[model samples]
Target chain A: QVRNELALANAQELINKINEKCFSKCITKPGNKLDSSEQTCVAKCMDRYMEAWNIVSRAYISRVQRESQGESL
Target chain B: KELGKFLESENARMRLQQSIHTFTDLCWDKCINKISNKIDRGEETCLTNCVERFLDTSLFIVKRLEETRKKL
Candidate 1:
């Protein structure tokens, strides 16, 4: 239970960082409020970000696998 | 409060998601040319390639630097 709680806390910290970075990228200028178009952009940006993350994670994992295989040979 | 612990856990998940989100945005900008509602086949490939190549590049650079140091 303590371990799970610790993991959750760590994950939350990561989210805050991502939000700051993504928001800056998606929102060029801060308007009075988030307009519909801006909101749409943010939504799309979030999805794209997730896709990119998966791709990178997969790539990294595969590269690690390949390196390990090479070492075994 | 119990809610405090729940909030903390939720925050952690958000953080992990956000890290991935940033990485995707950075790589997508570098590798993707066209932006649409869904990632097309070509763009998807580009993204994967980009990630692999980026990692390779980092590793290569590090190795090269180490070799240079050894030669010194």
Candidate 2:
């Protein structure tokens, strides 16, 4: 029960971040409808953002492991 | 016993995810100027370095603060 809620919150946060970041990157001019080019840009931006997130997560984890080992020694 | 381990792991996962969100927000602006079909090697490297240097800056500040405290 509790776990599900936590997972939902995490996903919700990611969605919000993606929307805010991609919107600015894609939608230079707000229109009544999103043109094809803007839509394509949004998709690419979202993919790149996810890639950036993974790269950051890996770097952070490795740094943390190294710091912990240094502290113990 | 099992429940305690599960909760502990979940707590760590949550913290890890939160940090990723923050780094993505900061690094997106720094590394990404134009949207492209793929993240090129340069941009990927920039994202990784951004994370490392940010952590380094954090540790540096803390150590500097401790030294100042000792002097005072």
Candidate 3:
């Protein structure tokens, strides 16, 4: 139960970030309604943002591994 | 007993995930310029390097603070 909540919270944070970044990139101006092109742009932006997040995670994890190894040796 | 171990690991994972969220928020702003069909190779490299450098900066600050404390 507690584990599930933690996972949910983590996912929620990711969703909030996606909303913030995708909105800023895709919506140049506030409009009454979201048009199709804006929707498309948001989709692409979200995908790229996720990719960027993965890249960052990989880089950080690898650096941590390297530093820990250096310290142990 | 088992539950305690599980919770400890969960907490550790949560902390790691939290840091990733912060790094992504900051580095995305620095590396991403325009929304395109795909993330280019240059942008990808920039994002990776951004994370590495941010951690380096963090370590540098801590080390500097410790040295200053020792001197004082």
Query: Global lDDT of each model?
Result: 0.69, 0.90, 0.92
Task: State the displacement of the C-alpha of residue B72, model 2, in Å, after optimal TM-score superposition.
Answer: 0.8
**Cα deviation in Å at residue B56, candidate 3?**
0.5
Q: Which stretches of candidate 1 lie over 4 Å from their true place?
A: A1-10, B1-25, B32-35
lDDT of 2 by residue, A1-73 (tens): 7689789988899889999999988898899999999889888988988888888888888988998999999
Of the two candidates 1 and 2, the one with more favorable TM-score, higher being better, is 2
Compare candidates 1 and 3 on lDDT and give the better one.
3
Residue A16's lDDT in candidate 3: 99
Candidate order (lDDT): 3, 2, 1
Candidate 2 Cα deviation (angstroms), residue A42: 0.7
What is the DockQ ranking, best to worst? Answer: 3, 2, 1
After superposition, candidate 2 runs with Cα above 4 Å error: B1-5
Q: For candidate 3, lDDT tens digit of each residue in B1-72?
A: 999999999998899999999999999999999888788999999998999899889999999999999999
Question: Residue pairs in steric clash, candidate 1?
Answer: A11-B12, A12-B11, A12-B12, A14-B15, A15-B14, A15-B15
lDDT of 2 by residue, B27-72 (tens): 9899999888888999999999999999889989999999999999
DockQ, structure candidate 2: 0.78
For each candidate, what is chain B's TM-score?
Answer: 0.64, 0.91, 0.94
Top candidate by DockQ: 3
DockQ of each: 0.31, 0.78, 0.81
